[model samples]
Target: MSRPFLKMNGLGNDFVVVEARSKPFAPSAEDVRAIADRERGVGCDQLVSIEPSARADAAVRFWNADGEEVGACGNASRCVGWLLMEASGRDEAVIETRAGLLKATRAGERRVSVDMGEPGLRWDQIPLAEEMDTKGIELQVGPIDAPHLHTPGCVSMGNPHVVFFVPDAEAAPVREVGPLIEHHPLFPEGVNVGFAQIKARDRIRLRVWERGAGLTRACGTGACAALVAAARRGLTDRKATLELDGGELVIEWREADGHVIMTGPAEVDFTGTLP
Candidate 1:
């Protein structure tokens, strides 16, 4: 038998969303990889499953293309939130995840805004191997005397991330250095790597190497992490527009409530069925 699914993308970070409320859909690591394979099956950066939830409108799960289950995905949450609102004819929806409950609302037209909750700045929360200054931790790459990348700010927006401030995001060696830092011994659970160029107090150019997914067009949580890291380091304001390869995302770290709001577009590419 086959199952109905939706192909969705947020800033070109695409996903294959499966509604499993009626019937449970549990795919193993191999199954996840196969479904994410561009040549053989439905291709996506991550696989999203929406199931019944008692605490929120629905419960969502995320699996990377490499097949590892993760706590949260900001882009997927926005996409799922849009789906729920459209189905219920409501403006807001709450989606639960392993990370926590996320609240999303329709920002405009095809845009959605999600409250990604407060970021985790403590080293233990980011779960670094040992306690250290999250603002530019002790790590480096390339020549010892003149490292290519070093002292990146760390933060956890549902997942781990390390942001490296660069003079030029486009020129940064994301592909070469991303994997090296992702598997760095300091981050016990691994981490997403972000290269950010501060364009202004309110703007930034960003790129991310997502954990397990490698390089994606955009990474919602990575954007949030970058903003928080920047603000903590006094590099940018609490709110900034992050320009990604696929598009742009507006991120606001609200001071009053200590919640990070992310607004972006979600597109329904097409609908299909699982083989």
Candidate 2:
């Protein structure tokens, strides 16, 4: 039987969200690939499923376009949060995921703020093949004498991320080097690769090659990871505006509670029935 679904986007990082609170919706890898196919199906960066939760408002699952189930997706969480709040007529919503419980609140018109929780800075937390300094791991690409990208800060915002600070984000070879670093041996479980250019103490430009999703217009967790990594490296302040290709996200690594708060816009493109 066909199912109703919502098409939503946060900063242009789009998703196909299915409400499974009443019925279980488990799609196989092939099914997810077909659903996310650009030519034959409703194309999206990820497919999100919202299910009933005993502890939180709902439980959310994320699957990349490549059909791999992942731990978390910040943009999808915000979108789902908005859906829950609208349905319940409440200002705040809690959504559970493999990463953990996330709380989102209405920030403004069509805007939502999510508490992404604390970042994992340890090597084992990032889960590299070997323990190393997370501030700047020993990974490099391009010619050995003159590497194009090197010494990236590592952090885990639910999922593993590596942030490479470059002089110019546009000049960085994201498409060319992204896949290489994603599959690097150092990252046993693979990782999201981010190319960031620090615009100022409170601003940054970022592009991300999401694990199993390739390069997306925006990556919410990537933005949070970038801010945390930048702050740890003393490159930027704890709070910064991350400018992505699709739009901008405000990320703040709160010191008191050590939680990362991400504020951004969520849009509903349309609603339809899944074939």
Candidate 3:
């Protein structure tokens, strides 16, 4: 039987979303690989499944292009939220995920704002291999005397992340270094890597290497993590506009609630049926 699906994107981070509430869609790792393959299947950074939920509007799950199941995906959440609101003709949508409950609201036009919840600051919270200061971990690359990258602040916005504040984000070696840090011994679980260059107290230029999805045009959680990491390092304010490869996302680490709010645009690229 053919299953209908939606092709969506949030700041060029694309996804193939299937509504599985009624039919119960469960794709195995191989199945996911076939669907996410750019040359042979529908191209996307990840695959999102929207399922039935008793606690919220829907329950969402994510799988990377490598067919690895992940706990959270901020960009996909926004896309799913936009779809939910559009279908219900409502301004808000609540969602459940492996990470936790998340709420999405219409910001303006195609823009969406998601409450990413408080960041995990502690070493154990981030679940590092050993106890240490997450603000700047003692990991380095290149020569010992003068390492290329060092002291990355780690945070968990549902998923683990490590942000390296750099003098130039554009010049950062993302593909070369991202995979290395992602599998570093310090992070028991693989980590998403981000390189950030502070433009101002309110602006930052960033690039991210997602744990399972590799380098993408944008990553919502990565943006949030970068802002929080920057704030923790006193490099930037509590909020900033993160300029990613695809576009910009405004991220705020709210002091009152400590909930990170991410605002960005979502779009419908097309639709197709899974054969």
Candidate 4:
């Protein structure tokens, strides 16, 4: 049997979107690995499946290129919102996920604005093994005596993340310390590592080392996490522009709603049939 799929990219973090509303198929790790293979398959950072929702909108399931299931994916959610709007002829949706429900609306022809809900900041919510006094904790990336980086604020946007504010995004040792901080002992389930360079109070540059997925072009959740971590530490304002490798995302932690609103573009690269 052949299944139709859409190739989409949310600020360069590409995804393979599959609609599983009618016919059901559970994608395995091997299946995801094959489909995400750059040379052999469609090649994407994540695979997104759209299923029937218990709420008014649809439900989304996110799978990494490695085929591991994830609690949430901000990019994939916007892509799913795009698909739902196209199929149902609606301009808005309230999609559901393991993390929580999100409200998505059409910002422009190709852009979607999503209310990503409140971020979790408590050490328990971030789910570190032990409690730390301050939101930021010191984790040695290289050597015990002299480490590469230390004292990163931890935040959870459905997934765990550690943000390191640096003087320069280019100079930050992402290649050397990303892998180390990703598997730091404090994070039992591991974490996404972000290096952020604040360009201004409202603009910042970011690079991420995702947990299941390595250094992707961009990570929406990682961007939100970075803004939250920075705002809490007084490094940046409540709202900021997160300039990622692929493109830029406008993120606002609204004081009125206390929900993080992420506005960005989602593109359909192509469509293919799964055989």
lDDT of each: 0.96, 0.96, 0.95, 0.87
Report lDDT (Cα) of residue 156, candidate 3. 94
User: Over the stretch 90-209, how does candidate 3's per-residue lDDT look in tens digits?
Assistant: 999999999999999999999999998889999998879999899999989899999999999999998999999999999999999999999999999899999999999999999999
lDDT of 1 by residue, 70-89 (tens): 99899999999999999999
How would you encode candidate 2's per-residue C-alpha lDDT over 32-85 as one tens digit per residue? 999999899999999999999999999999999999999989999999999999
Residue runs of model 3 more than 4 Å from their true location after superposition: none
What local lDDT score does residue 269 receive in model 3, on the 0 to 100 scale? 96
My TM-score estimates for the predictions, one after another, are: 0.99, 0.99, 0.99, 0.96
The total of clashing pairs for model 4 equals 0
Among all windows of ten consecutive residues in candidate 2, which has the lowest summed lDDT?
140-149
- Each candidate: RMSD: 0.6, 0.6, 0.7, 1.4
Better of 3 and 4 by TM-score: 3
Instruction: Show model 2 residue runs off by greater than 4 Å.
Output: none
Candidate 1 has its poorest 10 consecutive residues by lDDT at 140-149
Residue 16 lDDT in candidate 1 = 99
Q: Which digits, one per residue and each the tens of the lDDT, describe model 4 over residues 1-275?
A: 78999999998999999888888869889999999999999898998888887685778889888888888888888888877787778889888898999888999998899899999988888778899733678565657888666788889999889998888998888877887777878888788899999899999999998887889899999999999988988888999999999999999999997799999998889999986
